[model samples]
Target: MKHLPLFALLGGMISGMAQAEIYKYVDSEGRVTYSNMPIRGAKKLDLGPAQVISSPRRGEGGGNPSSASRSPTPSDFPKVDTSTQKQRDQGRRKILEDEMRSEQQLLDTARKALSEGEQVRTGEERNNYQKYLDRVANLRNEVTLHEKNIQALNKEISNLK
Candidate 1:
């Protein structure tokens, strides 16, 4: 039983060391991709042995080099008071509300136009139903776009802290 455990441990270590080399490739669209499988014109990366570094936990005596050299927030940094921030938030809310109202109006107008188009058949529409369908599709798409815009604006307004 002791020899079996040792043999299994050695097998696991050997399998872990047999990792395939990673290759990087850039496609014609300028997008980079990395994979273990070989690709045409792929460049192999030599990522030497794994590195292990230990750092003391926060509040420990082992001083942090970054904290030692860090400086306080500069006085020149722009900061808005709470009242000023509130005013800015209110102004943003008002603009978004106005845009939402405009989008709602546009959606209503599009729905009305679509309804009118469906009710009345023009001389050209009588000759070809496809034209009428295309117009109706366009109007419907306009209404959907306005609705989506309104929803997005509402979501943004709600997300404001």
Candidate 2:
């Protein structure tokens, strides 16, 4: 019975992958739209054949089969010189640092706002504690989000060569 559901899910996924004709049309308002279903005045798109990548056979590798099947970079692929790559890495680091500083400022602002919000009680919020709590919760979430952004920025900056 458990396997039946799994089979059904797999069947649905396979059916969903069936190719469908795509059409593009410009509406009277000059807006362009694309859909699988043909519409009046819509023209069928001549999309090239879909690219297919074969799944790695089971037991191909003891660990990750995909890693074993991974292809090396093509000979014609573009390459960046060491100096250019270093310059790009420096630029990325500078951008990440600037972002971290802005996030820190936002975190400080959010923290200050949350502290102020928690202290003040006025009007309906004084009697309705839930409303006050909701406001404080939103402020706290903002502070948390900013803190997380700063952490991510710091991690990215540290990863730079």
Candidate 3:
């Protein structure tokens, strides 16, 4: 029901474009309406002469996908020399290697913490073994997370050219 006005407006626009007659009306509730068909208390709307637009024909406007894909880069586009690009790649490799080293250190620390945590025993945990298990599980998760980080860093370093 709420879309009636939008539909009416579109209908009026389409009819107007076709040089067909349109009508406008305001009901007792003061809601405005537009339509191609006449109704009681509706007034003829003067939507002037139809407007025409023509689309470009085929390849005239870069519309061919094959030709577009083969288009050369613009003259003003920036270009990086082979040496500069190689230096950038080398720098990226160095950064990735440093990150891999850092992640390896973190993984070793996490593993040590998990190992120590697994061996510890407490009076409270003796009566509630689940608590101890939960603590060790958290430590294990930390170690696993660090290991995954190191693996990802190694993969990233290996990918560098």
Q: Write the per-residue lDDT of candidate 3 for residues 1-161, one digit (tens) a residue.
A: 99999999999998766557889999999999988788799999887777996655666655764465455789999999999999999999888888888888888988998899999968889899999999999999998898888888877877666
Writing each residue's lDDT as its tens digit, candidate 2 over 1-161 gives 87999999999987665445789999999999998888999999988777897755666653573475567679999999999999999889888988888889999999999999999976989899999999999999999999889888988988787
Compared with the true structure, all predictions reach lDDT values of: 0.85, 0.86, 0.85
The lowest-lDDT stretch of 10 consecutive residues in candidate 2 is 60-69
Error of 2 at 121 (Å): 1.0
State every prediction's TM-score relative to the real structure.
0.53, 0.63, 0.52
Steric clashes per prediction: 0, 0, 0
TM-score of 1: 0.53
For residues 1-161, what per-residue lDDT tens digits would candidate 1 score against the true structure? 86999999999997676564788999999999998777999998788877987766667634766564345568999989999999999999999999989988998998898888788888899999999898889888988998899899999999776
In model 1, the runs with Cα more than 4 Å from the true position are 1-76
Identify the superior model by lDDT, candidate 2 or candidate 3.
2
What TM-score does candidate 2 get on C-alpha atoms?
0.63
Error of 2 at 9 (Å): 15
